[model samples]
Target chain A: MRAVVTVMLKDGVLDPQGKAIGQALHGLGFPQVGEVRAGKVIELTLDERDPQAARVAAEQMAKKLLANSVIERFEVEIVA
Target chain B: MRAVVTVMLKDGVLDPQGKAIGQALHGLGFPQVGEVRAGKVIELTLDERDPQAARVAAEQMAKKLLANSVIERFEVEIVA
Candidate 1:
């Protein structure tokens, strides 16, 4: 199975990288862009057999490795 | 309107950051994880009045600012 995991800074968390990118975009002439928040995407292939099992494993991966629970939240989606 | 732009390193491009994250996941005992590619997701609010125009503007944003076309590709999706 293939899965996509997205990890993003929680609301109210400071995102310097995102801010820098937004500034760069503005400098590049995208003046209509109001606000920008940056996050991470992880695409992974897993060998888990069952859909439920894959979801469990993917969630575990998010909690244990993919996301920093202190300042981030993650979502996982399986792609067929 | 809101848009999500995903930018990822092209295949065959070296992704040290991705590799490091993969290694960290492995170290955390996710041995079943075969490969990992890290990418960026940018969420933005746009003021464009037309959807088609927003798409065009978003594409230009990807090319000129959000993505390094030399070794990356980007996809933008509008979410309301």
Candidate 2:
């Protein structure tokens, strides 16, 4: 099975890297762009066959190691 | 409007960072985990109101700056 974990900065958290990226994009001529926030996507190809099981496992991975639970939130999607 | 740009490494490209992350996860006792791939997700809050236009604009951003076209493939999703 395949599981995808999307991790993003939690609301109210400061994202300096994301701010820098937004400015970089603007300087690169994408003037129409506004605020740009960045995040991580972790794709896991797991041995688990059940989608529900894979999602649970992936969520655990996200909480334990893939993301900073205090400052980031993660969503898991089962793709296979 | 909001747009999401996901950038991922192309197949066959060496992913040393991802491999290291996987190893770190394994060492952390998450043995059930298998192959893991990492990517970037850029979330843009645009001035444009139309979803299609937001998507198109974000795609251009991905092609020109958000992603390294040579070794990465990007997918754009309009969330607003």
Candidate 3:
């Protein structure tokens, strides 16, 4: 089974990386672009096969180590 | 309108970051985890209303700047 964990900064948190990217896009002529937020995706191929169990396990990982819950939020999605 | 650009490393490319993440997961007791791959997601708020046009523009951004085409592949998704 495969699980995807997406970690993104919390709302109102300052994201310098995202700001830099937004600036870069504007400079590149994508002036229609507005705000940008950068995040990370962790694709895990796990031995677990039960969809519900796999999602629970992946979410645990996201909360425990994959994300800094204080400043970030994570979503776990099961695929395949 | 909103767009998402997901950038992932190509197969056979060495991923030290993914390795480190896997190790950390193992240390945290998620031993069932097999191979882990790390990627990035850039969420953009765009002024464009047409979903197709937004996706095309986002893909261009991904190809030109968001991702390194030599070692990465990017997918652009349009969202409201």
Candidate 4:
């Protein structure tokens, strides 16, 4: 199975990198962009037998290493 | 409309950060992880009228700023 994990900064958390990118985008003429929050996407090919197992494993991976729970939230999607 | 943009490093690109995270995961006991690539996710609340227009705007955003075309690719999903 293939899974994609997206780890994103929680709302209200300060993101300097995202702010910088937003500013750059504004300078480049995309003024409609009001805010930008940057996160991480991790794609994995797993040997899990089912989507439920994949979700559990992915969550474990996120909590254990892929994300900092204090500031980030993660969502998992299983792809065929 | 709300949109999510996920930008990922193309295969064969060196991802030192991902490698470090993978190493940390290994140390933390997730040895099933063979490789890791880290990318970015951006969420936006757009005022676009339709999905097709939103897609065009998003692609322009990705090409102009959100992603580096040389090393990364982006996918956009509209939520409501």
- Best-fitting candidate, scored by TM-score: 3
Identify the superior model by DockQ, candidate 1 or candidate 4. 1
Q: Write the per-residue lDDT of candidate 3 for residues A1-80, one digit (tens) a residue.
A: 99999899999999999999999999999999999999999999999979999999999999889999999999998998
> lDDT values of the candidates?
0.87, 0.86, 0.94, 0.81
TM-score of chain A of each: 0.94, 0.94, 0.98, 0.94
RMSD, one per candidate, in order: 1.4, 1.3, 0.6, 1.8
Best by DockQ: 3
Q: In model 2, how large is the Cα lDDT of residue B53?
A: 80
Cα displacement (angstroms), candidate 2, residue A73, comes to: 0.9
TM of each candidate vs. truth: 0.92, 0.93, 0.98, 0.88
Interface RMSD of each: 1.1, 1.2, 0.5, 1.8
True contacts kept of 3: 0.93
Better of 1 and 2 by DockQ: 1
Instruction: List candidate 3 stretches off by more than 4 Å.
Output: none
The residue-by-residue lDDT of candidate 2 on B39-71, one tens digit each, is 999998998978888888888888888899999
Better of 2 and 3 by TM-score: 3
Flag regions of model 1 displaced more than 4 Å: none
Predicted candidate 2 versus true structure: per-residue lDDT over A5-80, tens digit per residue: 9999998899898899899888888788888789999888888878888788788888888999999999998985
C-alpha lDDT of candidate 2 relative to the true structure: 0.86
- Better model by lDDT, 2 or 4? 2
